[model samples]
Target chain A: MQLALESNAFFWAIEYLATFCCGLLGGLWAVRKRYDFIAILMTVWLTGLGGGIIRDVLLGIFPPVGVSNKGLVITTLLASCAVAVVYPEVDGLKWTMATLDALALGLYAVNGTQKALMYHTSGMTAVFMGLITAIGGGLIRDVLLNRVPSVIGDSHWYTVPALIGSVLTVFSTRAYARGVLSFTGELVCDLLIVALVVCLRMLSVKFDWKVPGAIKRKQYRF
Target chain B: MQLALESNAFFWAIEYLATFCCGLLGGLWAVRKRYDFIAILMTVWLTGLGGGIIRDVLLGIFPPVGVSNKGLVITTLLASCAVAVVYPEVDGLKWTMATLDALALGLYAVNGTQKALMYHTSGMTAVFMGLITAIGGGLIRDVLLNRVPSVIGDSHWYTVPALIGSVLTVFSTRAYARGVLSFTGELVCDLLIVALVVCLRMLSVKFDWKVPGAIKRKQYRF
Candidate 1:
């Protein structure tokens, strides 16, 4: 059965956009890693859909949106191919990638939190899933490419923004549910969360505000 | 809610054993990669419980057993620490590792298939999930460690054995459902599938039967 998307069309639309951005980034990664065509395609699929799949699976939604949503699958594929074709031009535009990453992070964080709440998950779980949906695909992509996940290393405050966005989504949505927040207020909350994340991400990138000491020389094996 | 396990005591027992094996392997891998204590612990948890988590999520079972089953978590942690302690002594025994890997593969394949069938999944999906359960954790471990997944590269017929076991489990269980196979016959089928996989794995290891040209030099980027 299809996921119940009628109730949150706006959120899902953002999710799709985020998915495409992740897909393109994955393709870029495949190029950077010098992987062949098949590997690139596989990476694209994994990166584009991995987070949503993780979210859906955790929520006990069968035949995950990643698997059943043909439109999304095709969109990610096309995004991947397009990025692959334009890799040379895009490779030099570091600012563009950073912007896209921030935007995707914001979109995914909000969308993921909303979906988790829809499934009646606890607020804590919804926040966790929001982070997963925002960053899980890129983690998988990096892992598959045989690199330490950037999020755990040189992420430069990547997760903090997502976390803030997720927390905002969860608390605001709860307020709305309890009738403490108006519909307009709820809509503002959503936009505000997204804006906060994107802004935080851009500021982090500009300022290089990385979490210190997370990068350590390997010791104490096992 | 907990998974429906009342009808499959034997399967669950084997699954636990398999989980222990994977946890140990994860510990060993972490050691090989020279990760610190916390990273090792994370690896152990991921490798031990990741597959079951994936399976349960796909089947729409929320709050996965990995999160809910405290005993399993403790068990995996203990298993990982034990492996880490004894790794130097065990390092010389290559055959031992191959044997354990084979056994874990067999156990997970059968357990995954049975769980999928319990959920009334299509045979194809069941088989796919069975393979996922059997290998997904290892893939995660390798990826996190920045290596190509062994199943994709150096596995030497890994998927073949898992596929065979999964296929047998699905078909035999289906037969049992139709009353064409007696309960005793179904049990035999289960045992046979596991045995077949383990044996095939060992034989492939002995013969060093790598898949034909699945390995290619990375050339066509993006």
Candidate 2:
């Protein structure tokens, strides 16, 4: 499974695209916060690569690709520079930026689950890893800025799709391992899961769908 | 160095003690925030073990001791319970708790440096790892609660001691590796570094020492 994923150029393309999008998002966030240049650059890199680094470290993969991959590092720096220069103009493309962000989230979820399964972690752990990969960077960014992580504090449907995609990926991987699903079948399944997550996220955002908070007003009792 | 540290039961004892102290601090913070029992427990575990886990993961250590070691996990839980039940009483020992916390910070710094050196990381990386090990847990805890990490925001001399200790540890380890220092000498040096950090931290707190912020009043320009 690892070999198949590694050998697939499509997977690499998606991963890089996700990194770039995440970097851009992070850079924009830093700019909005009025952070200086160095901080903006660091924020971009962390937001783009933090999750993968955390995942790789957990799996005992040394010198995580975030730091080791020159291309990805360059991508983040480029994102920093781009956001720094194009801050005002980019505001007009909010929806476009958000769509890309959603795609990145889905890709990260798929990639994290694949990596966890490759490391031979249990299905439950793999799902957890996937969720972390998808949201960890944003979580770190929020924490660094001293804000409650939106995933934890907001009533958004962000984590739900990631969780669902991860579970589906694990199931497909299991089928592939058991020879009930072919390599191509597994890849297709993975792509579909990503699509499903992106769709769910986008729809939720468009329709203002929300996850219930710890206490709904109707359920509150003095 | 790795073999020596691993073989010495004293190293393990200090590491566990540091973990327990960190857990207690984290639990106290959570309780103060009025978090629920589950959040308090999670906070304790993260505060106690987060730094070591991050260090080990960065060094590619699988199943970090924090999660894999039953004893350490139990220690954090014990800390959680203790803080929950003895919150008010613990406040009376403020000075004592602060002293222990300083010691824990120093020990974490030493252990992180040692582990990074064991993995053949460069001296600079080792020092960085040491700082991370010493303060990563607190940073994570602060972030979770939507506050700026004290290490970054507070004018206190918290991180300075950890940085100094890490740098000193690296230098001593280098000397030891060059055969200029005996095994006993190295161990003594590590203990002295820990002591130095503890003293520096405690003294800073006692004297209200401060790290300069981004702008000093005299240097401020409108």
Candidate 3:
């Protein structure tokens, strides 16, 4: 089955929408970290586009779409500024931001996997590419903010849901290619994966579910 | 007349040696950060080869040499283990590490710029690529360790010399291409650039030279 957002204009809109939301979260994170406005701008750009750059670079795509696309750049900057301006009045908007961020993550995870599959990368590689696309920006942001990546820490199941969604994409794509799944079936699967991630993330957060690490927490103490 | 280390076995040895040194530093950093053994291994891999992965990816080189080169991988892991075992005896080895790291940085900067020029990238892009190659791993390392990148902050003049060396490479390569500079001249220029960077870095450290940032110290207070 054909991917619903692969070549559609609506996909571009959704991608930019996701970019804006991600940028907003990045800006909010900077503000909370007490970073200056310049740092906020840097964080927004990094968090909004870092994943795409990494995915494309790994796939050997030159001048990564993130770097070449002016619209994405503008969206990231504008969204960051808007977040900064609205942050003080949005004291109770934490859940709203988290929900939106999760949705964006789901979309990006699927999209990254699709691109990797299109490049004929292995299923494993596609899954990894998808995870990077979903979490890369945040990793860059956290690193710049001088912290271990949340995805690597004993945080909520951020990488897990992205991994699942990516695996689903690869599986669905392969099935579609073999005539086992129709285009409509593929579309349904895509939607289902996104929904699954959103639900999984919210549940993980609500229940305070944390991934167990290899080492005890005391070892992390410096 | 030739670039002494371009394709020589000795060049390969130096590259691997640099890899070992970088990996050792990474492992030492993990020890200081109170990270577990697994994290030390991860950091070693990241710090030893992260810059080259980034450089090649930006240049659209798939699988990154760092990924494909098993020798480099083994070197990083082994070096990390060695450092872990020898950490206690190396408490007084700060200058030794710094000098070797500067050498690696110079080599990487020049090599990255040369590669970019070979690919016909613009001079400005070549400079940026070179700078990235030289500093990228450390930037990643610092971020993972929960600190701002020294290159971005008012630290030693790490990036400046790399920039100068990169510009020199681009200019010298262009001159050689135009037949204005002899092959020997180009080789000499490359060596000079690397030497300049190494000396400048050492002097900067020795003299405690710092590049002052625009904002005052108080502004950085959270």
Candidate 4:
């Protein structure tokens, strides 16, 4: 009945926090874009909940956690309100957005991988799904607004951190060998991985770490 | 499919022209938004085929027709290039875009409905699928690009035209069921519906026949 016995509480708590962080970041993003409070709320809610809905739908699950989870909804609203009131103090919005977004990217990727493993998916599929889950909501947000997606663009360590988190999740799950593991151990691994991804992404931002190859290419028709 | 003769030929042509129109519109929209050519091309490709790809993937098919169909690829590229080159000379692009977009909406709606029917979906389900198919790509495009969706935001007959076209398609298919009309007759109905939608959209612009119903509802936190 349960995928991982000890993780039930951890998953829910982290999911709630991720939604909060994502919503806060999304609201601040709207501020940079000069949206109204309502627009900001809508965008934040979408960014916080959209990827989960999409993943659930793709898995043929109904109600999506987004629609059913009150915590996510309330967190989005709270984040939107916070951004509206406190945004004046957050100077250098671009840098703030990037830093917070990097943290979000790591958290989401780790969470996505965990959730996908719960669905009994293989390592490769779980990794890909995790990466998608991390960035998918933002992808939906950008694409719906008719802008290019940041995940697919040459932004700073956007997909790289997500990929790292995903890989860590897949390996950790495998290392457990689908068997039992101590709750504390699992949490320790999860935190270590998240911290690693965040640190790696931050360093990537500082030292220009990239995928080692042509991350960007342009093609034209004559 | 083997559902009806000329099915392949019809969809082949439909896919090409639809991609062209959508891609061209996407390119022009990017020009208005001040993106580079690659950005424009990416948006165009997404607007042209993203919806159908989602539909196919949801249907449990691999390598979605939208991707494997090279006609769509070439059409998307050519149309985006054309728009990029000619957008400057295309005076009064707002009105022009409105009309062309309306036409594309109708055609995609009809085509999407037929695709659903051929897949043996119930009429009501087909209608829902058709609406999603018609607008899903554009919605994704807008959200990714950090802009408001035109269909949901603009107090125009955007969804209205697509709804009308889908309804007409259902009726035409029903008539086909009764042997009251030939497939050619159905084709004729489709063409007429597309033309009618385009004309109505343009006339609405010319005469200021826009609907103002949802404007109040849109007055929210944003």
Best by lDDT: 2
Task: For each candidate in the order shown, give its overall lDDT on alpha carbons.
Answer: 0.76, 0.80, 0.79, 0.69
lDDT of 2 by residue, A120-185 (tens): 999999999999899988887777877777788876789999999989988988998889988888
Q: After superposition, how far is residue B134 of candidate 4 from its true place, in Å?
A: 3.4
User: Candidate 1: which stretches are off by over 4 Å?
Assistant: A1-14, A27-103, A119-129, A139-148, A155-157, A160-164, A167-222, B1-100, B120-129, B136-222
Tens digit per residue, CA lDDT, model 2, B99-137: 889998998898788788888887766876898789888
Instruction: Report the lDDT of model 1 for residue A192.
Output: 83
- iRMSD, all candidates: 5.9, 6.5, 5.5, 8.7
**TM-score (0 to 1) for chain B of model 4:** 0.83
The TM-score that candidate 4 achieves is 0.56
Overlapping backbone residue pairs in candidate 4 total: 25
Report the C-alpha lDDT of model 3 over B7-75, residue by residue, as the tens digit.
578767877887788777767777775555555766787788888888887887775766556788789
Q: Model 3 captures what fraction of native contacts?
A: 0.29
Off by over 4 Å in 3: A1-50, A53-100, A119-129, A139-154, A160-221, B1-17, B20-100, B121-128, B140-148, B151-222
| TM-score, per-candidate, Cα-based | 0.59, 0.60, 0.60, 0.56
Stretch of 10 with least lDDT, candidate 3 chain A: A213-222
- Which run of 10 residues does model 4 chain B get worst, by summed lDDT? B1-10
- Higher-lDDT candidate among 2 and 3? 2
